[model samples]
Target: MDLELQTERLTLTPCTDETLLTYSTNGYKLGPHIGMYLEELKKDASALGWGVWLVIDKQTNNIIGDIGFKGKPDNEKSVEVGYGIISTKQNKGYATEALKCIIEWAFNSDSVNKITAECLVDNIPSVKVLQKLNMTKIKNDNHMLYWQLNK
Candidate 1:
């Protein structure tokens, strides 16, 4: 299988019908919600290179989480990102490394000028990941904070 990105400890695998089905059947530990999102991505042709990717732990070859764009870059050449790591896997720095790899992959495209993300204001860990990556806080609403990083 072709990998979308790789870091020192993780391999980011693109979501495809075959891969999702195999992971589901083999009990590879990808969380429940991810399947639904991958199914949705299968319905959109443009999502081929812009959907979620499975995060694989190199040493254990375990499915720890997923990370990827919400969709393809928008008209403004900005893309939004989302990710999740299983509860047991949180705070291990996997999310941060996976995000950095994905960001680099996104910026490799000539059309992508910026990456954006948002999280509930109380989600401190997620906010910290954005901050650690040097994404600037662009705005805040009653319950959410928005951030962006330009290439």
Candidate 2:
């Protein structure tokens, strides 16, 4: 199914081949990781919602960042969520808002029951965003902290 997760100020557009082509044809400079996402999509059409989703600002109609799952949920029905916003757009609650929308979208799927994430230990902003989502700190290594939320 074609999906566009929406929030108050953002639209999370899944990075399907068609969507990526449309964005590129429209002169949007995609991130390098988008190529990898495209390759995965080429291998499996089911990867549509499991890869990068462009975070678009509803007002300015510009891409503010990207956020989405790394892959489909595993055997345990758990998936990892990741996101990043442009420095200029950071700290405006866009990450939290966009993530909340996607989280709700994911929970609506029977394939997903748990969502997880990881951030560098020193990345206070990301930590705050995950905390704002009410995700619990599950574990941490020397450099990264892991978090989780159950549906």
Candidate 3:
């Protein structure tokens, strides 16, 4: 795993089972109700080859959040990037930094070409990140807006 991605103010690395559990349950305990989904993520990571990772601040080495692609790509068309920042770290631009790093890696990888992200239509903050990345809004299926990144 390429766990040592160094950004201007952040360091990125893959998450372990214990750390992932802590992140998810802690995130859930605070907000977004994410605890129910942590197990599924753990199971999938165990069975699949890739999983989310931590974005650490360089100055403090504190974990900001987890971000990465999960599951197999559909017919190898595109890989989905999933991410979440700790409550205290939100709105400070850390997610964008981590996301750009991961997306750059995905695009450079042999298995992926285009990239995709799904966010609730009402999730304004996430939508802004995609926009900042220059992802196009292709369509909305149910309540999820599908955003795409392709060159």
Q: Which candidate gets the maximum TM-score versus the true structure?
A: 2
User: For candidate 1, lDDT tens digit of each residue in 1-151?
Assistant: 2355779998888877666654532334655656766777767766766777888888777777888888889999999999888777899999999999988888887768999999999999999999999999999998999999999
Candidate 1, run of 10 with poorest lDDT: 21-30
The candidates, ranked best first by TM-score, are 2, 1, 3
Any residue pairs clashing in model 3, and if so which?
none
* Clash list (residue pairs), candidate 2: none
Quote each prediction's TM-score: 0.86, 0.91, 0.76
User: Mind sharing the TM-score for model 2?
Assistant: 0.91
* C-alpha lDDT of all candidate models, in order: 0.82, 0.86, 0.71
In model 3, which runs have C-alpha deviations exceeding 4 angstroms?
A: 17-49
Cand. 3 Cα-lDDT: 0.71
Give the higher-lDDT candidate: 1 or 3: 1
Q: Could you tell me the TM-score of candidate 1? A: 0.86
Tell me each candidate's RMSD, in Å, in order: 2.6, 2.1, 4.0
Off by over 4 Å in 2: 21-29
lDDT of 1 at 103: 88
